[model samples]
Target: MPTFTAAAHGGPVKTVLVGRAHNELVYHGDVLNTTARIQAQCNALGSQLLISEVLYQQLEPQPAGQFARRGQLVLRDKA
Candidate 1:
């Protein structure tokens, strides 16, 4: 198994998710969850990176149209 490292750039987020090809498993964990959320946000906003409010705090006056505020979202059960 290959381990992946990820970092968020915009908002205040504690965790992130990511997905990878050539992997048997689909939902790895919060990492994967984050990846999905990022993808969804990108589709909605048409950007590359999706950051949380916390991250945005660190980077003020960030590039516009790159991030969208995703208010508290309830994630589904993780197995």
Candidate 2:
């Protein structure tokens, strides 16, 4: 069985070119870091997909019982 993990967050991010060649596009910011932390929880949670609260709130409302709450997750560097 193949397992997959995903996380989402809606916010501003800083993108810039990095590396010695200055040809690589890198994305950084609190939002990205938070998303990474959320993605890291997938294995432990045994879930195929994980969506952050920020993204969830931005999304259109869904039918009742369409999504289940996974409870709060304490992420690194997050107050």
Candidate 3:
């Protein structure tokens, strides 16, 4: 098995949805549970570490459509 290094742990999953509050990956007293599903999926996959899209956004945060997806990274060497 290959170990994937995730860089998205403990990041914000904020949204513009009405009647909701800003939320981060780790649950807190005030943060919404927007990232619960994704967190659960990662846990189920045995991925203790995660990459945070919000961290990337720290460079250039977008107004809308800020999203990130994960997949099994395949290594292929062509000789």
Q: What TM-score against the true fold does each predicted structure earn?
A: 0.33, 0.81, 0.28
lDDT tens string, model 2, 2-65? 7567988778999999999999998888898899899998888888788888889988999998
What residue runs in model 2 are displaced by over 4 Å at the alpha carbon?
A: 19-22
Ranking by TM-score: 2, 1, 3
Answer with 1 or 3, whichever has the higher TM-score: 1
Tell me model 3's lDDT, rounded to 2 decimals: 0.43
RMSD (Cα, Å) of model 2: 1.9
**Candidate 1 residue lDDT tens string, 1-79:** 8633333633223433445654453333455455555545554455555565545677758677665676754434422
lDDT of 2: 0.87
Clashes of each: 17, 0, 5
lDDT of 3 by residue, 5-25 (tens): 332334444444343464433
Alpha-carbon RMSD of each model: 10.4, 1.9, 13.4
* Top lDDT model: 2
